[model samples]
Target chain A: MAGENALNFQMIEAAAGRLAGHVRETPLLNSPFIDAIAGRRVWVKAECLQHTGSFKFRGGWSAVSALEGAGGVLAYSSGNHAQGVAAAARAHGREAVIVMPEDAPAVKIANTRAYGAEVVLYDRATGDREAIGAELAEARGLTLIRPYDEPLVIAGQGTCGLEIARQAAEAGVTGGDVIVCCGGGGLTSGIALALERTAPGFRVRPAEPEGFDDVARSLASGMIQKNNALGGSICDAIVTPQPGELTFPIMQRLCGPGVAVSDEEALRAVAQAFLRLKIVVEPGGAVALASALFQGDAIEGEDVVVVVSGGNVDAGVFAEAIRTYGDAA
Target chain B: MAGENALNFQMIEAAAGRLAGHVRETPLLNSPFIDAIAGRRVWVKAECLQHTGSFKFRGGWSAVSALEGAGGVLAYSSGNHAQGVAAAARAHGREAVIVMPEDAPAVKIANTRAYGAEVVLYDRATGDREAIGAELAEARGLTLIRPYDEPLVIAGQGTCGLEIARQAAEAGVTGGDVIVCCGGGGLTSGIALALERTAPGFRVRPAEPEGFDDVARSLASGMIQKNNALGGSICDAIVTPQPGELTFPIMQRLCGPGVAVSDEEALRAVAQAFLRLKIVVEPGGAVALASALFQGDAIEGEDVVVVVSGGNVDAGVFAEAIRTYGDAA
Candidate 1:
């Protein structure tokens, strides 16, 4: 609770080196259509295309691979990180125990199991998953991996920003805004730190779902904030009650006051992505693009980088996303 | 009507250079899970992520850019070519008039209109779209662009193979099998020509939907063949009655015996793609992947490159594909 995000540029570079053969160097995509919608040039780092269908794989792999003990790893996540840990652990022939919420998508739970992890579901509304995870890790002598607060986890996610730095250099850009979907500030803080060292002129703007905008509220008030509710959003991939202790301070230092997007706007972004970008994006993943398209006046930068964070959602949800808002095409 | 696929590798390289900054360098993806299922390394060139959500964009841009008189362009397509022509013509500030089947996906018609093309729908069961297109082209003084037989079109589609060659070199693979979805063999023939010149060790194998396996039948016999029926398969995008006049020759010379997948297998591949690859692949575009997964004994390659040619489908169709086959994840 006391320490800064402490991840430096060198650590992130080392993580990149560590993850060279293990993780995907996800592509950067741009469309004139997306640019027109935002009224400016916008680039999208398509982490939705990453393994485990999210950028969470980077952190999960970084943490799992660095585990020196033979006991393997234990973690808690709604879905994306669950699959990430399971997949990374599988790659290394290590064991993974994922404590997931019962309300998480069936596809997510199934994917985590298919990746060869032992999964335990808990009632997210009534049970404390973190406490359950700690008990299991202690009982089994397994190393517990926090989703965003862990130093190695933060370092791992920063590798994405490092790749962005190199990719942006290739694209002849020294500066811009990186709009990242936020839950607990892990990816945003890590990316901001990475940019501060390597890409100097780039800034981070966290995008959040409307009611669960704790990070955005925290950024504006200069204090930790909490959402009044948690489970109503369609953006299930990212719906934290508050920012992580380790991530909040760094976000305070590096990111602007974030923007929040409505569920309707996120669905619209999902449809636009499917229509024009030809990719599948979940509600949480589309929030950044939603902010970029709908909150243009509030954000800064002529050239913006919107991170499409994941593409894992239920069939009915995706259908609604496409059928309801597809006419926007 | 009886010429060969006269596109040389140099022509493809020229098209690539010509279309630089205009066309996207689509990413190549591979999944270990997919590899395990196929019992080999299957590299997927994600042309679904390409502009207009298909490889058709390449040919459209290539032919449109080479237009000398600039009377605008006219084409007859089921759907993809309509979008390709619309997108390319819009980019070049030229008019595009597309004769599409009236039964094509509503999304396809919407996308074509979004790109500013004038669409004329014809009944596939009763009318001759080619004749309608030709008549309109002559009447409106528009240049008629054939789907696959046009030399420039074939050369343009070959750019995908060109990029694959460079990407394969970077990945240190000298040769493999290139599995391509075939309607009239535009993309398949173009890639065959490109690979023949650049990576001679790689063999081409065309994949088609079961009921519409004209190309596969044509490859088996020593002459052009036609499907007994048209427009029954779920793969509405690739339902050509027969192989193209120009494309068939190149495919016959360069490719091995082609494989065909049932509509069920194609749906499974689409679901698998969504679950594992986190990409949206339409039914026709998924045939190559379906063949690779289900007909592995027929294909010849230690390393396989499956061209996921397109990702344009109705929301309901995609939702059904996901709900039905996504359980494999």
Candidate 2:
């Protein structure tokens, strides 16, 4: 579990070069309104506007590209990652097979299919998508693209942090802290590695939903912990029971103190982003903003960067979230 | 009246240079999904993400910058224009006095003041904002910045269409048809002039909310038509009763065809934009999209551009709009 040979500046630089024409260099938006509220400077990396509506595309594209000469790819994801894999595979003229839970949102399923992937649905109660994906990969000799555990994937996600660092420098802001919403530690670990190489003086922090605090617990205990009984949360995108083995160690070594916020806080943050920044962010994407807003005192008086991880919520869910939290404010 | 020599491409070019460093060159997004729905190639000019959440800032900044060396400026508006004027004036290091209706949203008032403008509220039923603005201008010898009627303001607004043309060209798509949501004809007229100069083959069309179809009526009559009974619509931004005298002739001469859409259509378009594009566009901004979606046959098989004019809605109003149209498929 020692952070030996983990992601570093070199890997991130290579990832950027590989992803130059493949993925979008999403805008890093400075929020004067949010800054006034938090009494500190806040810049938001809007990955919500990325292709396939999330940063998952970065990792998927990077992994598929790295395995260029390999067969097609197989992945197991219920949402954004599914679309990402599908898109990345199509972009490289390779076939992608996504194992998704049958109960996944129709919009997500449609998006996955739209990216030209064949989706295999399994019952969430009794089926194991990983086993199905493994079988498929073995049968077809396709590479199993792990969502976060792979070095290539982590390097790809690091490009987001690289862009943030570059944009911040271009905007004349020297250095500060970078905050990212953690699900399986993919984005957070990648950002940490990217900042370490690009903006060495900057600190990287991970923000997680309150109920699914596996990363926080893992960091505290120095071991990955499973929270199978925690059930679903509004930030469903980050509801992983345990972090990937490859990502956990890097995250532990490079990420700053992890912070957790309530489902209500995340929902409010989504609504706040829509109201203040006129950007629609999914619940998981809003976790970083939630941490910055409700926990302002924790990282006060320093320039802060919040990673808006995605924007792919169902209209019904978005409306419900807005009604519940938008009205409360 | 024939089109006057008052507004010209040279003036708009100058305005573009003057406002270059001040305003954001908002994105012009191409959507294959929207194209499939509308049966044409559709590009959306996302002014919803513009500074102060509207295209008004372009003209506001141009007008204020033109007179910053003179003295203070006064404007009369109850909505987005007021905020834009205040922000632009403040950015130019001048004082702004805004005459707003008493019933204007508190958010608009707060936003105007946040930019350091003095907000003077008057009862819409009895008070004349124009008289108040004139008096303030006379007493202080300050320049009166009209919301849409002035030549400089029109030139400034033209910059949006200029950017649209440039973006379209950069994306390898050239002239076709451009649809702009019209209020008092400022944006449509300005955009028409810009497109005529830059993309000469491109046709400009103004889309108006049904009851306030003054632009359409004015174009048909060859004169500005006043409709005092224009009903309240969800598109509060472009619900003006009449086309501006200065804006009408230019619009009639240069704009190809005018279209009208229902408030429900506008609301649905807003929901679609939020869900599909992750951008919050106000009802007026959505009008162009609505026209495209509902009246696709009007401009069939053409490379169409829809201007998403603004994004400044109160949470309550936005929630209501979402609830009403978000599930419309």
Candidate 3:
């Protein structure tokens, strides 16, 4: 499948202008405990605090607001992107249809519906959500918003990198690795492109879960790769089968070497964030943080900036993480 | 003992200037679900994300920075204040000794010590902490930084209020109740003084946990009132014996009627914060949020603001809160 055209900083600036009042500028947090564990200065960009509990909202708002005479929008996701697109569509006074598997968490479905999105549930084993989404969009005149392999979406995610560039400078961090939890590489590539122009001294590193380190393997081999297995890891948020067609090229051009951490490390990072940083972070969202703290030898420099991309985990999972790793973390 | 002299907004402004680089300007958050529950617009000031995981950092920095060639500092707190003062003191390259009860949580003690402070453990059943703190301060020639009764501390906490006024106005919220989790009334009175000058349209309201509703009772009686029992509720962070002498007068003159909520309500608020806002809120820190969501009738106007003052909680407590109230919230 083909992807959208390349993005530039100007597009990100335009997206920023469009998203000024609509998107939140999430805080950058650090704890001495986190720094001590990482053996360096560790700053966490709390994107989990962003609207819809993820950085996906930036892309969602950017795409929805840029629409011309929009009828509505359609998206297929069982996680952050669904709520993000729904909320953005509702805020723009346009309808949104979200296609999700029937087996997805009930809370996620309810949250998406709460944002005024029309949720179309399909059987994950027998039905294709993309097909359902496309049919619904065609019938309703709804624009299909791809999760990551889209230009405006990448530009929206780039706004986060812009903030990091400025915030790191403000915090006296002129040079560091900006670690991002990678799924389809939208956030990772967008940040790389943003930092390429704004903070060239800083580099972007894509961090993935251990068994799903396709981005890491792809970066090392200088070619895109795919994950063999998909559904076992607890870090489901960043477990895409492969990198995005649009984002991979940008990442290859701009990002540093990729990093990966175990699911246990991700869960431990979730516990530490809850204990020391006083924020809710899901296993997938904590992967970047895990790489920053546990895989410190893989990264260079005295300072590291990690983006916690989202925080929408089931209560049982969160409970298990905290109970199992809270003390040790 | 008599309290320190009354404070003014200028004092808070001076504290802000001193704390420009030392303290974090915490974010203000809101969720549509929260607003739906309240039947109005509700914004939460996430002081839990502040340095030391509480707004106490502001006052700590203010007190520590205002010192003139100080020898060192001494403080008494079993929770947030201990870590806050320790961190502020460490940032200033000054020695600090924190006096805590032996029965206090080991994690709190370890966190305080981790901030480079000397820990002095006293027997809660037999030892007079005040006498021990005074003696140690006198012997070591260290200045005693009071938790809330001191003028500089109140001025420090008021910095949070200054930010709130500016942020609320930016959010198009001109008039509303600014609810606070009250303990010694330091944070409540400090915000009242600040908003009195910067945002007169906004009113401060103290929210206390049930059975520890000294501030609410005191506000009703127009005098200082003490809680019948001190150590029972899960909301231990804001469970003060009584309102401060310095703070009561300010709150009486500037604050609106007080509000109170039960422990279950506070725990539920914590769960809701974790789910919707993706921020951690301990039971004590969540009372104001509980009041805003569950006791909306006591508040006025379409827009209401609540401060989640701190997020230093035990894993067991937090896990229990999420397990019991996560789905319902």
Q: What lDDT tens digits, residue by residue, belong to model 3 across residues B31-96?
A: 999999999999999999999899999999999998998589999999899999999999999999
Worst 10-residue lDDT window for candidate 1 chain A reads A1-10
Cα error of candidate 3 at position B324, Å: 0.4
Q: Which stretches of candidate 1 lie over 4 Å from their true place?
A: A67-71, A101-106, A120-132, A135-141, A166-176, A327-329, B1-5, B36-39, B69-71, B101-106, B120-141, B168-176, B301-303
- Kindly report which residue pairs in candidate 2 clash with one another: none
RMSD (Cα, Å) of candidate 3? 1.3
lDDT by residue (A223-250, candidate 1, tens digit) is 9999999789998778998998989988
List model 1 lDDT by residue over B1-329, tens digit each. Answer: 32562467788888888788778788787777788888988888899988888999999999999889768899887688888878999999999998888987676777788789998999988999878988898899998888888988998999999998888777677787789999999999999999998888888899999878889888888799999998689987888889988888888889988888999999999987887787889999999999888889987768888999998877778878887777654
Every model's DockQ: 0.54, 0.47, 0.78
Clashing pairs in 3: none
Query: Which is the winner by TM-score between candidate 1 and candidate 3?
Result: 3
When 1 and 3 are scored with lDDT, the better candidate is 3
Q: Highest DockQ: give the candidate number.
A: 3
Give the per-residue lDDT digits (tens) of candidate 2, residues A1-329. Answer: 21438557787788788788668777667546677776788888888878778999899988888775758999899888888889989988999999999998887887788789999999999998878888898899888887888788888998998888888887667677778999888899898888887788778888888868888888888888877654678888888879888888888888777789998888888887876677789998999988888888778447888999999877766777766665322
Native-to-model Cα distance after best TM-score fit, residue A195 in candidate 2, in Å? 2.7
Clashes of 1: 0
The TM-scores of all predictions, comma-separated, are 0.91, 0.93, 0.98
Candidate 2's C-alpha runs over 4 A off are A1-18, A66-71, A220-222, A225-230, A324-329, B1-6, B30-32, B300-302, B327-329
The model with the greater DockQ, 2 or 3, is 3
Report the lDDT tens digits of candidate 2 across residue range B1-329: 22458779998999999987568777666544566678887888888778788999999998888773658888888888887889888887898999998888887888888878999899989988888888888998888888788988999999998998887887667877788999888888899999898888788889988878888888888777876675578787788878888888788788877899998889888877776678888888899998887798777447788999888876766777777766524
